[model samples]
Target: MPHRRCSLWLVSALIVPLAAGCDDSAGHDPADDLPADAAAADRGSDVSPADAAAADSGRDGWIDGDGPDASGDPPAADAGTSSSDEDGGVDAGPTLDCGARTECAGRCVDLATDGAHCGACEAACDASEVCLEGACTAGPVEAWTVDFDFGGGESALVEDFAVDAEGNLYVVGTGRAAPYRTLPGSRAGGFVERWDTDGTLGFRQVMPHLEATGASPLGVAAGEAGRYYVIGSTVGAYPFDATHASAPEDRGYVAAYDAHHAIEWLITTDLVASRQLERHGDRLYAVMRGQEANAFPIELEGVRFTTDDGIGFDWFTIALTTAGAVRWGHGSDTDDRANGLAVLADHVVRAGYHTIATGGGLSSHRYQLDALDHDGTTLDGYDDFGVPGGSAVAEGGGVVYVAANGPDGWVLQRYIDRTLDWERALGEAVHVSDVVVDARGRAYLGGTLSGAHSFDGEHLGEEHDGWVAAFDAEGGLRWVDIVDNPAGSLWVVMKEVEVSLASGLVYYRYRVTSRDGERVVALRQPE
Candidate 1:
């Protein structure tokens, strides 16, 4: 793979540089690319100051001076081990012991680049795999070859999708008639469908209450026990309503269904706008944005919303037990809108934007990322000013990445020590829809870019296409690709993108206009 290095020119967009050696080439082992003179330098002689400085700077793109022992001085030598010091004396950092042999997959193998035990214990590789940058891979995994079109007339649109642990796919959106019988009050509106791994439809259930309420499915989240939840806003009155609907009231709703698309429970809340749903542990987390709560003590089973003190748009987060008991609820005190939610480690991270006044009542919105403990106590938080869209967070390898549309373009921020480590941006201004970080520290971002755009140093022709980009751990661009119509007449707009950590594949849904009607298509890409 060719290294896609970032330009150092600092423009309006805060473009950052990616290290040259960070790219992973097909079948290329990183250990084999080490400088030939490294062994001689390790002999404790002929070491130059510049060479030490280069190592300290992390020119190789791995460990940097951010480590505790990287203080620009020769580290204290461990017992029975020595290396050349700054003054040509014997001193060095701690030595690495691979024991009698490198351990991998519960067995001892080689250390100088054995594929099974490349550099550390249990770092086993597949058959015929090579150790590149200390990572093992057989090769590029096959991406999905899926094509689906529903409601072929003028009504099809996909909003979101999710993959369960068993690799089953769940897609939710608004469309035509349901392919199967649905729950009572089901109408010709939003629908939820399940598919096998090979793109075969298992069942499609028309999500009800949308026809009368004029609501559509916004997001879908699959639970641990083979259950799934769909959240959206509806105008119709439900079984739990306190008052029958005289007119359309935008009330938020969350419904749980079994693997066979049978409704288990349905919940409706006074909070009018629902954004998304996420499941963590045994609790279901739902986020919504609603206007000032005029009605105090609006109650749902085990949950309540009160805004007796203020009148403005509010974002609320509610946590519920598997059986639908609200465990806790949190809400913002400002005019904030909830964008997304994720459960990372022992904390729940909520991302969105809140507005701040500039002067004379004019205001601009800034993105905020808040981390809350399991019990809903606020912990560390970050505020990104001036970005139009709120930042979205994804966790991988204990690192959290936040992506947003900055003043100039799409920006990705990395936080280390709960503080900003690096901020990177793409050159062109594009509407970023979603972002996902992988276990290997790579970030995959999807959105639509109009006209011509550049990724790293590579340029593409002018076209309106849904674009997906990959960035290495060091914030270097790996590759950029586009999804467009072969005829080049239709505009492909990405609606949502989801990544499967287990399969290391990206699944995205987009929309394009055809002669028959509007078509919503889903495609997959290899990680």
Candidate 2:
């Protein structure tokens, strides 16, 4: 049978205090829970004469006078009240008090374990809900989540994501497709899928081109009128000769997909690697990393290439019209690569890190951010942000916010007019993986943390959990919430975080592992 409801009620009441149990064990032994005859059978002795005489009068062998008769039945009435020794017969046992205000879906149920009223009332779970590790989660999670191992049993990784104006999600990743388009280990192709606002799968497609080695979709951006673009580097020919560059074996590609999921256009470039892409107005700006300057031709308009003598790489930005026409480009010979990009009304910002020659003939990296004018010229640049491993950029309330991860911790910087306004760190030693800035100038940060950490005076417990915190424009923390895993399990790691501008809902994706197995979960923060 299922775990006894009595045990569940006992544990739930002890933890939450929503219910209370009757304490009838002050003078009772653990053996009192067993039946009288069963207890006697374990004694290996017949009932004594005195005990039999007492049972004949009004009691059984039980110490209390409220046990069953020798025949396992309640005793007859002696006066206005009856003397009985049965579990539920003639007041033989005391009543249990579960609490006075337990309610769920208009029915009395345990909130700690009830699927229909987990954590709060009316928060019904559509699928199976299990209270594992002190938190309630529904199986086969539906919303704000995409599990790569859901059905195909293939190992996959989510690379890039884009959210549309209507709160829909577009995700691209690399993995072997199933049933429809199957590729072997080294020949895996890129896959893209869209999720509607209600968490339903809209469509799924695998890139038709196959690479001899592999390909990964590194960036995605949503544009006007529901259109979107997918960009990545390919290891083999892309099949479309008209769009591929002279040497198609190793190149980067940018493909546009219409609102109806139809392929509109495809283009290839000599750039060997592409990291990120951002759409502004009627144009797209892509950060491309190249190894040799000779690989790019000067005749290609809006296309600039720079190289560090083939010893290091050059990072640059290429602007292209919606119709795949190059507009403007800028290149730099620094030993760095751009990781993030954001466009504003008057300036375009790129955030990344560069390797610098240090003392002792060594080299170290430093974070860099540059503001470029419309003509692809650097108007201003800042390089004192520290060494960053990954970064993201956003604009809100005319202020630009850049969140990055470094050796120290997570650093968030706010800038106005290419000048620093303020900067803050999450804590002394924690990893902040991703951040999102809403239109109201509210910043949300997500990462992994251990031990007790305080954010803006809000205390998080001394446990390993996924943490998401919100802060106002003035760098004041608003709230911090923890998404804990099962006890004794490894700490939770955040993979992605995004907020829907249209719904004001914050979505985060995290992964956790326990003795039971591994799980990738997507959860929404309650308002």
Candidate 3:
């Protein structure tokens, strides 16, 4: 964990010299000695001097004052002002007494209430927030929340979600029984729903279980002009198209839906499960996995990949036009699991973990990041001693961000031009669920934390909590918000996170575990 020096201007006035244990080498400004009212006002409440001092006691490198200055003697009350110079000559002029105001950028401003300079100079609050008690307070407001009912013996497990350019949200998941308002007789099936920006349910399409084995939609990606794609697996015949029926064996599928929720085209293969889908330009990329023997002559359109002996499971990546025309297909021979897919302007990146035979029938798991050219050729590859989790690519394909379970803990890495730029260890026992990068190259990660963990300089206690964090382009920790578990809930898990480019709001889906099973909640955090 990296230690960040506490900003000097934010410290209280009653502290002794060494008690400000942080690096004090920076020149001290007169604004450091703010009046007691400013301290109380910053907290939005009245407090005694001792109480104000105690408020920062738990902060890193902050301690109670007990001794004098370096000269072994206490300084005068008005230490910021001196009548004479250090050489004992006449002073330049008398100092100004702004009374209750701090001098910031050559102006007397109330630090406690100034939104542009809250707590310290230039510490501005967000547009939707106000400065209170010297701190930026308010939202990241929850714009809205919507809940779904599984009805009867059915339960919902959100597989993936996406937000289109028009701010409409699309969610895809699996339900054990029929969803609310839907016709009954379905045992287990997959569902897709669209919600308007204002939380109105635009449309809900439920694909019921037609066979003994169920149907599950694992991934979704929004395309241009009000179109979207979903990739998943079905154990029986094709559910969307009757003329395209298949065998009882598991089959992977990719279905395209138009603006009016009408199926434009549907494609299927013997590839078992397609776990992730990504859209770039007019093309769609999907990653699928299946046992070699189960999918011997795996075929998608005219593209094909064959295996011998059908020993272990293999993963494949297929590129196709939005009209369901397969462009190319690439497959891995080893035992690997695909976790995520990110499409850039010129290429696509696949993130997952690969198992290697370490002799004596033992194996080792290594994180794998492979960059494939737009034409489905391997352009570059990276592998390390970890388990790859999720990945996101910045705009223009110039940078990439990946999250993995490293040897020591959870780690987030930044890659530029297919090269490792930097890696940051999140903390011990942090389970990262998803990662997404905005247009400005900022990365947002959501997950759950257990035990004690330090994110940048912020410390979380032993209790479990869900967290959403933002980092800059250079991998610097910007800020983290913890979603505490509610009462009567055992724990919380963040399943997915998506950043709406049109609205700049971050939407995250979380599940709360209680005595009655798990409940799903979706919240959009305002910027």
Candidate 4:
């Protein structure tokens, strides 16, 4: 069962009172009184009784009650209706007969339609939201959320997520081994989970653990024809294939799966790690980083790529066919790191940081963006943003947006045809993890905030809060939303943000430092 958080409702003048028909006959179902569209939006039949019980436990800020007397137990019917028991203690009044409604604070509330108690006892919908089929939704937009955990004492880290053409979501992460015996002496392995458009989990495949010490899937991309790809690094022999054993060093692997979750093809490389993967049309592009000295004269797709001196780390970008055959591969012999990758109509863009050795043995980092032809030829110059790298890149409508950390704060720059279009400085103390653009030329950035910072007019400076913000093509701020962490959690960081082309909904994947493993939230783009 998937865990869900009930939408919050403002308690001031915006609170909508419960319907008077809630106190009707005992057998009356409140759903019948709802509007035709609202009644059709109800998804209560999809939630099992165990799921409802779990939601009642108040897991992810969805409390079961509202005030001091908001316990799961029913309150006294009247203030003076209590009676004394045989032991001289005051006995509480009889529980209210709410019929089909739930008793919250001594009042009967229809959980299915009551905005004040939408899904749980005293749970409230947002001010702009209405209770529909036990879930809070904003008009025609359906809110989808799910929380995933591996098991007890096991930690899971969500790396990336992608939405398929059918609106199904796929999340890739790594899970630490639990105390119980599964494959003895295994440390950790990777996993991929899929959720359908209706917020139901389709499948979860935990990778087979052989004798590998660590296996982490760092990136994922959804392709055509119900195909998806996962790229990661592993130690010891590759866990996905036993026939092709690798040395004890870190090796990168990319695996393609069909609609039935069966592996269609797998490719392993001598590279250290795979940073990012993007699929565009009939081709797939990926960027990887590794030390050339570790594996000299690396062979990828029968092509030999050798570094200049094998002294510094190098980054490689490769284009591959849908059948896992490499078409072209390009490598850079420098101390550079791969942060983001995006494919355009005629070029593949790579964004990251490059380290330059200054005088007196000091090194300085500068943001680097490179454009390459589809045949692995480097295009002429790209404008230097003069900021530190570690940036993320996204493309939409032939324009590219890069988000990087600048001396003043975080900078978002727009580029067209390798030329600077415009730039904006977001506040300081903010680190951007990923940036994505929707089909409508709207760019969205997701990251964590440390100190006080302002996004347009909204202010969010919580210690470690996750946030997502949107921007128009003309560099105007749309809106920003702060994804507050649950109480008592160590921190929360948004790892990736993806826009569903089919549904036009934005999905955010974040990790909470609490016992809750990872959470995926979907929201419709506001008009």
TM-score of each: 0.64, 0.64, 0.68, 0.69
Indicate whether candidate 2 or candidate 3 has the larger lDDT.
Answer: 3
Please list the residue runs of candidate 2 whose C-alpha ends up more than 4 Å from where it truly belongs after superposition: 1-144, 150-153, 176-178, 181-188, 208-215, 240-247, 292-302, 305-312, 333-339, 381-391, 404-409, 461-464, 485-490, 513-527
Q: Among these predicted structures, which one has the highest TM-score?
A: 4
Runs off by more than 4 Å, candidate 3: 1-137, 149-154, 176-185, 211-214, 239-247, 294-297, 306-312, 333-338, 381-397, 454-462, 486-490, 515-527
Q: Candidate 3 residues 1-527, lDDT tens each?
A: 01111111100111122123321110011111221111111001000111011112111111122211211111111101101121322232454345566655555666665566778877887754545557776534344444433111224455678878766677776552322222233343466655555444444444545434334566788888878898877665544532343455546678887765456887766675554788877888887765547545656677775433343366777788888899877776433343567787778887756667899999776667666888877875444324634333333225677887755777888777677778888876687877888777778888887765656554453356777777777777665656776677666666677776454356776655642222223333323
Best by lDDT: 4
Q: How good is model 4 by TM-score?
A: 0.69
- Model 1 over residues 1-527: C-alpha lDDT tens digits? 01112211100000001111121100001112222211111011100111112122221111111111211222111111101111322232343233554434434445433444556655665543434434553322222323233213333445557777645567665543322222344434555655444333434444323223344565788776668888765554432212222133546777776654445676666565454687765778877655555444445575565432434356666777667777666666433243457666677777767677799979877777766776777776554433666456666665677787766776888765456778887655565677766667677677776666666445452456666676778897765556654353465555555655553345555545432222222222223
Instruction: Write down the lDDT that model 2 would get.
Output: 0.50
244 Cα displacement, candidate 4 (Å): 6.0
Model 4, 1-527: lDDT tens digits are: 22222222110000011111111000001112221211211011111111211222121111111211111211111111111111222233567666666676566666665566677867886655556667766522324665544122434556668888767787766552221223434343455656555454454444433442344566788888778898876555543432333346546777787765556787776675554788888789877665546555666769765443453357777788778988876677432343578798899988766678898999887877767889888886456555764688888778888898877878888888878888888878777988988766678888887765667544444767777777888878766667776677666667778876455456776666664455567654443
Clashing residue pairs, backbone N/CA/C < 3 A, model 4? 8-125, 9-125, 42-133
How well does candidate 1 match the true structure in TM-score terms? Answer: 0.64
Q: In model 4, how large is the Cα lDDT of residue 504?
A: 40
- The TM-score that candidate 2 achieves is 0.64
Q: Record all residue pairs in model 3 with backbone atoms less than 3 Å apart, i.e. clashing.
A: 42-133, 42-134, 43-133, 154-177
